[model samples]
Target: MDTTPQAYRPETAILDLGDAFYDPVTPANFPETHLRFRNDRAAAEVGLETLGGGEWIEHFGRFEPMPGSLVEPLALRYHGHQFRNYNPEIGDGRGFLFAQLRDTGDRLMDLATKGSGTTPWSRFGDGRLTLKGGMREVLATEMLEALGVPTSRSFSLIETGEQLERNDEPSPTRAAVLVRLSHSHIRIGTFQRLAYDRDADNMARLVGYVLRNLYAEEPGDDAAAQLLDRVVGRTATLAASYMAAGFVHGVLNTDNINVTGESFDYGPWRWAPTWDPAFTAAYFDHAGLYAFGRQPEAIHWNAMQLAVALRTVSEAQPLIDILETFPERYQRAVSEAILWRVGVVPLDSTRDRALVQAIEQGMTQSGIGIDRFFFDAFGGTVPADDAFAAARAALVGYTARKPRDHAYWSGAPCSMLIDEVEAIWSAIDQRNDWAPFHAKIAAIRHMGEALAD
Candidate 1:
């Protein structure tokens, strides 16, 4: 392995925030490190693209702290509402923030691990991650990123030689450790923890830290209100993006909602096959609480929780005012997101909203698959077929962002439907053949590059 000095400028800014926010923890020793997936695109962000597979496995899988980074991992402390019920006991039980580095854009990013070890919050269960879960997350992040969603990038995935017992899936199942590169790991629950304790001083300090790190350009005066307003906008944008992508996050717990507005911690997630508003991703969600259509509501609920937490530092009225803007922000964002995905520049807000509304109605009435609708209607051009006549008429005058002459515009769009994901997993699980999975990832990346322009 070439151990050349890399351009990884490490930072421990989070560690300097306060010891009350996290507990120091050690990573588990995996018996084996079998590199399964490496996100070269994400690696390039942090200047780690030159590292060999062996070197990557040793550093990520083995939990070795990158040089000049944090010497030890930190299990972040946070309390969240799980299913609207407050759970003060929940925290990072099976993962830790391994290191932090500056990306090519000079933005701070954290290299965090999942299924790598145990922490004080582990309670009574083993701190391990199933290999299937890791694979699913990698696919979810890749697909979501390609769809232009602000999301965490799956940086590395390495299989650990272990058989784990679980009731959720067939067990004993294989295990692995995953490292995700994300903008930040701080969550709404992080503030909830301080508010729960009624520690106004620490709450104020946290607000300052977040404002400086996450929103550096914002005015320092009334930072709490400014942060809440920014969070509301970002959260609204996130909900809109999910809806436009036809993604159901399944879990919208406050802890799952990152403070930086970047989506991470993929659990039970799925893309809607059709335009079913009630479609759910988790089997346990019998009530459809976090269903496809209800995601905006769920996110808004989480934002209110954040506002409640911020009350410890600022007045309640300001936070409430910011929270109330969620509906308008979400509506505007949904229109903009749809326009972006359809590969067109919105002529105006009213026209864009009408176009989005028309498309949604058309999809529902015709029972069109979301992916197919987007693929066929690139640049807002509806098909000549009579079935889409209404949709075509709705977008007749819209202009494309660019000429739709790319070869990508001619084929079926890449989809991450459940069946396709299962088939990819089955090939690896049954035949031990990873060719399908690799090929699917390559195709998804190609789609992403094509759409990125």
Candidate 2:
């Protein structure tokens, strides 16, 4: 928690190499490094106006901590059941909170590094991220943010010039460093680590820190209960957003769940082209643990894991009761989101149920284009044959490829209907006619403004 600012110097920045919590750093030996993207606007938002350039060749390959920032050596100890196997030997291996800054909005956020170097938790591997992996994360996170999902933003991408080998993908792979701006880098595993290690005192301190920093509005014993409730609510709402947006967070590990309830750690994630509940993006999810349809369940399970970790200090019954509200909250938020997306305001549960069920059936049967369907529907363009063909093409990529599911379509001539919409959409696709569409949606939204007057 060092508040004193120091002159920015990449060379003089404290490495804190001796901390066993991360992989030991060998001086970054790289041929070249590069800066692919610099989030100048995001950096400026957080009052970080200056940045030092790194050798592009070196960065694409080993990460060296950028000098000139306060290095807050944070060991966020937490436990997580990886794939449901409770493991206590987990912590910030090569990643740690470097510094936190209050942004222009006056909200405190962390500037954390991945692939900075190895720490005690670096069991037996190099602490470098592959260049491709880093790029994917940057793209995935930004897309999630634009889709209105609560997510971490990538601050910067620096190519660490190092030659590393991995079993998957090419050997002697290039490395890069990634910077993420998030509400808090603390995860559920942070709590589990202390709880399983019998470090209740540290767990208490960590919980207090979380409350003070992230859940400041909810404080004390009652506040802590409120914080859990807020987490539950936020988690449910976030899951609903994911569902509405057709996003599947491939990894829903307890350690990946943020205490602040913001979505971070996008890994092997994908957008469900069709509304299938069992759609999962993670290639390694042999058991379909964190699929698109199962996201709410996965979130609830993660929350339960968090509740168990929180039980060390907080009352278990209250936490459990709060966790139980996740399903209802998820259902409500998801229904409301769909109505909003479809340019309609939901009036009752009956309407919501009908719309959602219809959409699901359509997606399951004819395999609708989630984005195109909504956009076309919002534009009042009915689907046509070509549009259905495009949707079928999109569905070909699903893991569970169902080509002839009669129950899905309910005999709706989706192909012809979608093709009709496709014709209208095709005609206007290139025209920058945001004016009309914007006005239409705006009018619908401002119907309230008119009513109030």
Candidate 3:
């Protein structure tokens, strides 16, 4: 395998793969693993080709390089706050950034394989991922992107015919390797290491590198502070988007949060089918700190911790300014997404609030499929008046405090038609009438185009 550079950067901008990210030399071993999901299109987008054939079992999960490929082993270092407390001992653990490519669009992206055998960071544990865990990540990330959530996508999952031991699930479970594409894998822990080492020079160097690589247009002495602010703003925006979609990231660990504001590491994640603020998806979330509703707050708090790590070099006020924008930015993004889902055009604040409140009430009464209801309304294929009686009956049990047949929209005529439509489509969508769902998405896309002009 060739060790070469696809592109060159200023020496200062090169990522430093310290011992923290590297593992001691060990032969990569994987067995009996099969490719589960191969994202060839996404891989091709970044100038990568699949490396499997009839002898795939011989190469996959092994550290062998593909033809015309460069292998640059990287071990990233960063610190994180796990479960709300500072933890200095966290890093890549087992995985490393293997190579990066500049796609046809001239955008730099990484081709990273998790469970590609262990390195110095393995720390006495098998440096591999469970087949089940990798499968869960593949599903979660794919579904999230389809739903418009900004997430890292899995490119490939290869179940190594190797048996692994884990406490959480059945022992001797299968092991697998996963490849994911992302803007950057830098995290809050990345900075925490410098802060902990009190290496102000390396800290500044890392910040400058991040600015040039991650935010190239914004580079300089003042760039570090500006970079932190931008990260805060983008992080806030992402958090709000997560809330709007009713998705819960069970683990808000600092290591799991990407500095680029992309959601990574899908462990124990869930999407709420209804607007239950307290709904939790993580099985181990005994405290419920990161429940669906508290995601924004958790993000803000995580940013605060990251800000603390950055404070060694940056000013406190700018970080505070960025944190302050989180709530407002989140509100705007979430409101727009909600409005679009409900089929309302050219949204106004008053109308949005009215519709949101109405939908919340309706959800309680109708037992409607949450995502389907709004999608169906936009299609304009609502049930006839006569069918509403049956739809109404379907929703009655969902009402916790009020009668399901309370007819909440009896007086609110502006929303009555959409509500009724929601009831009818709720029933149809359950039958997997995806054609209607597809049509609704197309109609919304058309509306978006008209507004853009």
lDDT of each: 0.88, 0.62, 0.62
Model 3, span 1-453: residue lDDT tens:
643323321121234544443433433666465666667556666644444454333433454543344344565667788888787776666677655655544555665667776666667877788766775676566555644567787877777778888988767776778878777788888888788888877777677767767765556566667777778777877786676556788899888888788888876777677667788878888899999878888888887777887888888887777777777766666665555444344346655454455555565456555554543444122233442444333332221221123232122211112343344344433452434433443343343332221
Which wins on TM-score, candidate 1 or candidate 2?
1
On residues 29-128, what C-alpha lDDT tens digit does candidate 1 reach at each position? 9999899999887887788888887789878998777888899999999999988989999899999999999887678889999998899988886889
Please provide TM-scores, in order, for all candidate models, with all chains considered together. Answer: 0.96, 0.74, 0.75
**Ten-residue region with minimum lDDT total, candidate 2:** 408-417
After superposition, candidate 3 runs with Cα above 4 Å error: 1-27, 49-60, 65-70, 343-367, 379-453
RMSD of each: 2.7, 11.6, 10.5
Error of 2 at 309 (Å): 1.5
lDDT (C-alpha) at residue 387 in model 3: 26
TM-score, candidate number 2 = 0.74
Candidate 1 Cα outliers beyond 4 Å, as residue runs: 1-6, 384-390
